[model samples]
Target: MKDGKAGAVTELKPSRPLDHADALRAHGSSLLLIEGNGKLDKVTVKGDQAEIDTIKDGLAEPVSVTAVGGTGWIAEGKLSYIIGDNKGKDPGPFTLTPVALPK
Candidate 1:
């Protein structure tokens, strides 16, 4: 939750704060995914913000993507092998057949 410039952290008031014209940026070690605005970006925030008080059931497995938000992913074999994106639900459960290795 610290904002810095050049090499020092500076405090700026809403009136004198730096321009947010670039973008609303935040960084943290962990993140959580939530639902909002009929989208999936509203429920995300930096870990330092809070204990990630999610109202929804939330994703099965949550992973932090650069301290931005929670992301979904499919993993297998104790996380040794994984495939596909799990951020969102799978409307249709597809199958992944293994290919025969070289004889």
Candidate 2:
């Protein structure tokens, strides 16, 4: 993993599943746990738009993510994000629960 001006670059290999929580910790953050079967390729949030990489069946694509109030986010039928509460600092440890959107 490498961090650049844009963001962090992580190489994903099929040898093992990536641990979301560990990934966040590497960036000085915390992610509780993801609770769903939806496969995520990548997630990028800019302004009000969140670009999420989604994988369905065996195909992968990119889609927009929608914020749900101030605590959650949804990408239609692809994925859902439940933002964790930060006690104080903005960059503090927080939980990120990624659940699958209901069909």
Considering every candidate listed, which one attains the maximal lDDT?
A: 2
The candidate maximizing TM-score is: 2
**Cα shift from native, residue 51, model 1 (Å):** 4.9
Q: Write the per-residue lDDT of candidate 2 for residues 1-103, one digit (tens) a residue.
A: 2364566554433323433311110101212222134343333444444334442322111132332333323232222232333333344333333334321
Clashing pairs in model 2? Answer: none
Which parts of model 2 have CA positions greater than 4 angstroms off?
A: 1-35, 55-103
Q: Each candidate's root-mean-square deviation in Å?
A: 16.2, 16.0
Local error of candidate 1 at residue 4 (angstroms): 6.5
User: Which ten residues in a row are the worst by lDDT in model 1?
Assistant: 16-25
- Whole-model lDDT per candidate: 0.26, 0.30
lDDT of 2: 0.30
**TM per prediction:** 0.19, 0.21
* Candidate 2 total steric clashes: 0
Candidate 1 stretches with Cα past 4 Å from truth are 1-51, 64-80, 83-103
